[model samples]
Target: MQTALNNPAIIRFLKSKFKSAGFIDGLKIRYRSLICPFISLIKMVQPGDSVGDVGCGSGQFMLLVSEFATPSYVYGIEISERLVKNANELFSTLPRG
Candidate 1:
């Protein structure tokens, strides 16, 4: 899964989510929005490990962790109930590997 983060489709999926969530305006915000969580996930998570994310906006970063690594369980903590709801709704659409 080393190259998973580099896939255009993966990036697009994440970008769309952020856009849909009104978290970003366009491609200008994509790199900063995506890379921060990508780096955090890569540096901190491991396959089959349980993971938790605080301030997990839209839960996209948690989803990225699942894609970039095979976490056994994933949970997110968000201050916004709306974002948590949206994230859960979006997460249901992701293909499980």
Candidate 2:
């Protein structure tokens, strides 16, 4: 099976999710997604599972889950209101299942 990281379309979609963000924030989000073991974490997510990410900066991991997995519910908490706002905006652009 092709992992989300290896799938160009998935990567493109993920990048597009951050297009409205500031350049530095977009870069940071992409960089964190690249460096973190999100793929491994993603693999553990079962379909219809409830996922939670604490300190989810811009909710990148949650976005990944929404794209790569079918979670019943996703919750994220961030200390930064700015990041939370950014995450909510990005999430709003996601296609409804």
Alpha-carbon shift of residue 13 in model 2 (angstroms):
2.3
Candidate 2 backbone collisions, by pair: none
TM-scores of the models, in the given order?
0.67, 0.76
- Scored by lDDT, the top model is 2
- Report the error of model 2 at residue 84, Å: 1.4
lDDT of 2: 0.75
Best by TM-score: 2
On residues 1-97, what C-alpha lDDT tens digit does candidate 2 reach at each position?
A: 4345544545576677656668886666556656767777888988889999999877777987877877888989999999899789878876765
For all candidates, what are the clash counts?
0, 0
